[model samples]
Target: MSQGSSPTRETSRTDNDGNDADDDNDSALGSDQYSTASITSSTYHYRQLGGRSYPNFRDVDHWEPVDEKQQESFDIRHHIYLMQNNQKLFNAPVQPRCVLDVGTGTGIWALDVADTFPWAEVIGIDLAPIQPPWVPPNCRFEVDDANMNWTFGDGRFNLVHIRDLVGSIRDDEKLYAHAFCSLEPGGWIEHTESFMIIFSDNNSIPEDCVYHDWNRLFDEAGEKTGKSFHLAERIESSMKTAGFRVLGSRKKKVPIGTWPKDPTLNEVGLWNQHRWMEGLDGYGRWLLKYVWSLSDVDIELFFTRTRKALRDKRIHAYELYTTVWAQKPGPGGQ
Candidate 1:
């Protein structure tokens, strides 16, 4: 979504027609389904960098910050998606009895799904132990790394959900393979992601826009980690390789500021702006400090200008969001 003189509202491509909002679920396998590790004081020992909190996980190099401000950004992003999808949790046709949310940052989606389906067992897992201790009776959270071999015993989950974890995943196919193995026959795995690059269809952006170079730096950082920020475009192929038959996929243009003519899109752009303003720094901090070799002053200046550019509604800038859901083969191998 973008800010500037109103160009035509961008249209998204979808293989199957649908309008539904969904959140991700996660679980780390143990003898009892949820991982045996507990969220203790050791897990809470987060490193405070630039006034943002980050996990101390040695296994994976997660770039995003895990502070209260960042969590609020995540919640706002959730509401933006809900508005985009007409408030539906999922488009897949099924009454899920069990759901697994991988990379379930903040655990908001899992809690909502648990409340929506009281009888269902909802589990969420992530590298950080930021999820609240008290949750729905049917919902639980685990602190675990998703890239490691998933031990969630095979054929346990009816639905596996993931969202907004593009640059964090080092191997997309391997992650999908783990999700494929954990799902039951006929179960569904849904993933939602957004392109990191900014786009404007009507030349709304100035020639000196900061976005042109900002996204490239992210790509370079992702390359160092062996993860691709453009994984949204590759979701289906990876899922297909993991033996999943495509169920449906949809795309939407998420606006950056209130630039659109439609009321709903205008609101979406407002939330998107809030998201960028509040969280983009968190999104790029680690990468900038460790990978990009930028000094503190340069990082601050870059972010300041990016924020300024994002607020310019005359730029008409937006990012593309893609949601893909697929099913594993059922009884008799379908």
Candidate 2:
């Protein structure tokens, strides 16, 4: 069934603060399918950076919070997925009985999947309590760090889904191994990520453009922070090393602006632009401050220029969106 057609357990809901408000209850996921150790009570505190709030998980996680800008970007990203893949979730071959969503921002994808497969339990784990309280009965959200040892039992999940965790995960190999061991025999693991590198087929982007400089700085910052943005390019090899049978992978060129001639691509570009515009500060603020030691004013000036560059349709630059899925060996396989 399409994500839009999935039934929501609640018609209206409140914000993350548990306030009574009229909001879409269709935006959350998780139902506590697996058991994890009780998280420390000191997890709810947030750190402020560049006028945005981020989870302070005692140095365990360095991800920004699901603030207004991030929420808008998440919605735009959801739209981009529909325009590109035409589905809320991937087309993995497995029929999941239980699903795990790692780094489940806002719990939107997990919620949609729970509604789509009401029989399967869906759990979303993030560093912050950003998910709405009202959600599908089969879906629930938890605050935890994915880098630590997974507390779930072996073979507990039929499908493990991770998306856009490149800049947040320090050791992807370990994460993949954990995912491989957590899945049932013949279960699937799907990873969807985008690269920081931008490309142009027609050489529209100039050498001296701020976009190129921004990417270079971003890459260097990620390397210094030990969270490389290029991790998506190595997912296939990592999964293979974890004993997963390589299913297949696909890549799509996502434009930075509404410059594509094709209708679908143009729509994709529009959402992508909106995502970047809304997320430029949240994406770079912490990195620039902590890694590069740049002042807040300097970072703001840099992003102001970067946003202008992103709006330049003459550049025709695009980022690569890659989806890779693999399955664990069953009894028949070695």
| Candidate maximizing lDDT | 1
Residue 62 C-alpha lDDT in model 1? 68
Q: Candidate 1, 178: how far from true, in Å?
A: 0.9
lDDT of 1 at 183: 87
Cα lDDT over the full model 2 = 0.75
Candidate 1 per-residue C-alpha lDDT over 10-93 given as tens digits, one digit per residue, 9 for 90 to 100: 222121123110101222221112222333344456776788777644334568877778888888888988999999777777
* Candidate 2 residue runs with Cα over 4 Å from true position: 1-41, 61-63, 332-334
Models 1 onward score TM values of 0.87, 0.86
Per-residue lDDT tens digits for candidate 2, residues 140-248, read: 8876667755766799998999988767776788888889889988889999888878889999988878778667866887787677788788899999988898797
Quality of model 1 by C-alpha lDDT = 0.77
